[model samples]
Target: MSKILVLGAAGKIARHAIHQFLGQEGVILTLYLRKSGRLQKLAGDSVEVIEGDVTDTRHLQEVARGQDVVYANLAGDNIEEQAKSVVEALEAAGVGRLIWISTLGIYDEVPGAFGRWNHEMLDDGYLEPYSAAAKVIESSKLDYTIVRPAWLTDKDEVDYELTQKGEPFKGTEVSRQSVADLVVKLAQDPTRDVRASVGINKPGTDGDKPSWY
Candidate 1:
């Protein structure tokens, strides 16, 4: 059984991931969110709900105990700090597997007009913190796979592709379901993409920006 702790459990992508794990054999979910009330019903019988902020090291470590995998789906200006706190808590708890969510532009992996448009659209507020968080996770001793997705959409489709850290990132928009499916894959098999930062997007969606933009 995989004991998975999902930080930012109430988040869009995280919600999709939670649903993906439901009814699956040997999968137990711990939903950790600042406001978990909204997610209580979603937890069902296979989930343990914890209400708290990801930046709280004490709470993070407490919940992180015995977790086979830690998946963080967090955002905000303090994302760098939040990622640092998670890494520290996991280290303190001796947990080694982490599936961290990041954005495609965090590593300047996008190219051409898309790259320019992605940066201009996100600016520093989004790019800076996310990139900073990715750096923290990459340098950690933990076995981590940082999954960077392109512009996310509310669409439910699961079509997606992988772009290695050094490879040029593709696509302009991908469904939240697509990103969550990757998380499910990584968490189910800890050794799948260890110590790598990968980019994900729907194949053939590449353009100046996402279709919605």
Candidate 2:
């Protein structure tokens, strides 16, 4: 069975990914979050939920042990610290595969007016720490795929496309479900996109800004 540990499991995207992971065969998930009771109803044969802070490296290491993949869907002002804790914990636990959710513009790869707008919106306190966090994950020896998603929407559609690191980010936004789909795909195949940072967005949605903005 594919034993997966999902950090920040209560996150919106992680919740979606959890459901998708359960839909697959031979996949067992351990959901790690600060409040286990939030996902208590999901605990059962194929799922296990635990309450633990990812910043607690020792505790995280214990939970990560024996897992084939670690999917992190985390965010906040102290995101870099969280990334450090996750890397340290994964290294100590000897788990090498990681799938991290990050946002677009971390690399200044989003071009033109839209890129400018993105910076204007995210620069205050969001982008800097996220960029630092991505650097932490990239510097680690773990086989990691950093997924940078475009402006996210609540749209339920799954249409999306990908762009690798160094390529210009496409479109202005993508559905949250599309990002969740990509996370599940990476979890299912560890060898795909190792050590790569990818940008995901919906095709034809390119604009100076997301449609909703």
Candidate 3:
């Protein structure tokens, strides 16, 4: 059985991941969120729901104890600090596997006209911190997979592709479900993309910018 803890469990992507993970047998799940009411409906008998801030190392360590993998679907202006806190808590708990959801432009991995547009759209507000968070995750000895996804959509589709680190990131948009699917796969195995940063998006969706942007 795989033991997993999901941080930022109230977010859209994490919510989807929770639903996906519920379908698996022999997978034990713990959900960490600021408020438990939002995801309470999905808790079922298979999940343990806890309410707490991810930045609180004490709270994080409490929930992360005995977990084999930590999946984070978090976003914020202080995301770097949160990431650092998570790393600290994981280290304290002696847990080593982490799967973090970041964004594509963090590494300027997006190319051509789309890259320029994405940068202009996000400015430094999102890029700087997310980039810093990635650095923190990589700097730690934890077995980590940093997932950078292109502009996310609410579409229910699951089709997506991965752009490995050092490769130009592809596509402009991908579904939230697609990102969740990848997280589920990593959580199940926890060894597929250890210490690797991956970029995800739908193929052929690249353009000057995401259609909605």
Please give each candidate's TM-score: 0.97, 0.99, 0.97
Q: Number of the top candidate by TM-score?
A: 2
Q: Go through the candidates in order and give the C-alpha RMSD of each one to the true structure.
A: 1.1, 0.6, 1.0
**CA shift at 104, candidate 1, in angstroms?**
1.1
TM-score of 3: 0.97
- Candidate 1 whole-model C-alpha lDDT, 0 to 1: 0.90
Whole-model Cα lDDT of every candidate shown, in order: 0.90, 0.95, 0.91
Minimum summed lDDT over a 10-residue window in model 1 is located at 38-47
The most accurate candidate by lDDT is 2
By summed lDDT, the worst window of 10 consecutive residues in model 3 runs over: 37-46
- Give the TM-score (vs. native) of candidate 2: 0.99
Clashing pairs in 3: none
Tens digits of per-residue lDDT for model 2 on 1-213? 999999999999998899899899999999999999999999999999999999999999999999999999998899999999999999999999999999999999999999999999999999999999999999999999999999989898999999999999999999889999999999988899999999999999988999987
